[model samples]
Target chain A: AQRVTQPEKLLSVFKGAPVELKCNYSYSGSPELFWYVQYSRQRLQLLLRHISRESIKGFTADLNKGETSFHLKKPFAQEEDSAMYYCALRDPYSGAGSYQLTFGKGTKLSVIP
Target chain B: DTAVSQTPKYLVTQMGNDKSIKCEQNLGHDTMYWYKQDSKKFLKIMFSYNNKELIINETVPNRFSPKSPDKAHLNLHINSLELGDSAVYFCASSQETENTEAFFGQGTRLTVV
Candidate 1:
């Protein structure tokens, strides 16, 4: 079974500090990885996807197949960036063409000013 | 306008009570899904429907039933809810394509006393 593992339960960092949230996945076939963010009292939204190869709000994640990791990174974290981050993986080979995502335990990011 | 929406943002009911959560998406996506977030913030896929067809049904309890009257709405009904079923339920939608990302609604926090 495909699984996503996010090792950190909570991470605290000072404003303007670089931030990296670790994510690792276990899947046999090629995997599509994504990062979703949930702000305080807000709905979850897509932050970025590996297939897009784009950065949203200064966050970028590179897919490392050898390491089975897709770590979200930011050059300088802001207080506004404080939110819960979840890593998800979609198995393309899962039959019926259903969009089922296996999500990791979210990491609560606390940015201290 | 809200792209995806779920009714009754907070629901508190006694155990063994029957409850239902309604979801609607204006994004006109072809796929809708139900996900559960446990107390520890672990998100897991519960069920998925594409064009009102059940495509992915995870190892959820039989008490949990998903109904999609159309492509734009997917509602979840729980019968004989237990304390263990208390969690945040999220409704999401996505296009039936490999590269499309899922858009999520504000979750329904269901508390079974």
Candidate 2:
């Protein structure tokens, strides 16, 4: 079984404040983790992946294997950072039974000015 | 031009009706997927196809069927739709390897009246 858990339904923070959205997963096999963001009136897009270890739009997420977590963080929240963020994990194998993804319920981040 | 596109940006229908949503990707990717976002904004993978072959079906109901005529297109058809089926449906695609950040199309908002 594979699952992703996002404990926070909503996270509101003032501009310039740091923000963190927590995610946890349970997968039997090696996993590929991703963070996706959907802004107002915009299509859902990939923010970053754990494999890439890259930061985009001032946001970064660290995958903590010990804690079984992949929490997204930003040092300074901007008004434009408001969006729905989803954490997902894909089975690494390409075979018929293992190529799909399991996604978290998602957290809505509101950056208040 | 849009890299990925899904037809019927909005659909309103009564329960028990049948309908289909078409998706196409112009990115020449070998993998395509259909995802359902519920009212609470949880996105779940319903189906995945690789190179026109069914690769993943995430315990979706038999009423929901996905067809892939080619590597670039995947369509979903639902039978005996229920009010529970009302949600936002998204189409996505990605390359098989290197560049695996999936690209999503503008979602189709389906409302069961």
Candidate 3:
């Protein structure tokens, strides 16, 4: 079974400091990876996808096939960056002829000003 | 207009009662999905429909039924709701293919007393 793992239950960082939220996955084949974020009292939103290779809100995630990871990173954390982050892995279910996203438990990020 | 929307954002019901959550997507996507977020913030896919066809059904119990009347609507109905069924349910839509990004709706927070 494909699974996404976010080892950090909570990460506290100072504002303007670098931030990295770890994410790893277990899959048999190439996976489509994504980072979803949820701010307090807000709905979940898509942060970025590996295939897009586009950074959103100054955050970037690089897919490392060798490490089976797609960690989200930012040069300087901002107060707005404090939120719950979820890593997801999409697998193609040939039997169903569709794709399914498996999400991690999520990590809460706190940026102190 | 919201791209994806779920009715009754907050639902509080008693155990053993039946409840339903409706979802609609105006994105014109060919696929829709139902996901459950437990109290621990762990997300898991419950059901998926592609072009009105049941594409992926995870290990969800039979008590849960998903109905996709059209390509733009997917609703979830739960029978004999249990205390363990209290969680936020999210509806999402995406292009019915690989490497596609999903658009999530504001989740419906279900509280089973």
TM-score of every candidate = 0.96, 0.94, 0.95
Ranking by lDDT: 1, 3, 2
Error of 1 at B105 (Å): 0.6
The per-model DockQ list reads 0.72, 0.59, 0.64
Model 3, range A1-113, lDDT digits (tens) per residue? Answer: 88899999999999999999999999998888999999998888889999999989999999999999999999999999999999998886554525668899999999999
Over B3-88, each residue of candidate 1 has an lDDT whose tens digit, in order, gives 99999999999999999999999998888899999998889899988864686564798899988877788999999999999999
Pairs that collide, model 3: none
Model 3 iRMS (Å) reads 1.9
Superposed by TM-score, candidate 2 places the C-alpha of residue B35 at a distance from the truth, in angstroms, of 0.6
Runs off by more than 4 Å, candidate 2: A94-98, B56-58
What does TM-score give for chain A of every model?
A: 0.98, 0.94, 0.95
Q: Relative to the unseen true structure, what is the C-alpha lDDT of residue A11 in candidate 1, on a scale of 0 to 100? A: 99
Supply the global lDDT for candidate 2.
0.88
